[model samples]
Target: MYLLILGLLMALLKFLEFGFLAEVSWWWVLVPFGLAALWWVWADSSGYTKRKAAEKIEQKKRDRIEKHRESLGLHKRRH
Candidate 1:
């Protein structure tokens, strides 16, 4: 995400001919975007995306259960 954001910012700056970025080649300005794409590919292939999605789904399930218990006037028992 950070890489994506940075790449976009640099691209915008270069496009607008801002300061040092004005002298930068389009290829250089686009390097960050390429890097961001590579990072995403690596992350996806390594199962990071799947793990995070699973964790998010598990959290939602836990929240739903807790809300249902509360609505039914149930209390959590101590272990």
Candidate 2:
């Protein structure tokens, strides 16, 4: 995600010929996107993406339970 964002920013800057970016080749401008693609491929093959998604869901569940607990004065709220 971060790499994709960086690639977009670089593309925008290159398209606008902003400063030094104007002199960079198209290949260089596209490197971040390529890296992002490669990262996605590796993550998917390794189950990294699924694990991260599961972790996020778990965190949301925990937050919701903590909020309910705090509302009911059942337990101390975590930071």
RMSD each, Å: 2.2, 2.9
Give each model a TM-score.
0.85, 0.78
lDDT of each: 0.93, 0.96
Model 1 clashing residue pairs (backbone): none
C-alpha positional error of residue 35 in candidate 2 after TM-score superposition, expressed in Å: 0.3
In model 1, which range of ten residues has the least summed lDDT? 69-78
TM-score, cand. 1: 0.85
Write one digit per residue (lDDT tens) for candidate 2, span 1-79: 9999999999999999998999999999999999999999999999999999999999999999988988899986469
User: How many clashes show up in model 2?
Assistant: 0
Tens digits of per-residue lDDT, candidate 1, 1-79, equal 9888999999899989999999989999888889999999999999999999999999999999999998998958789
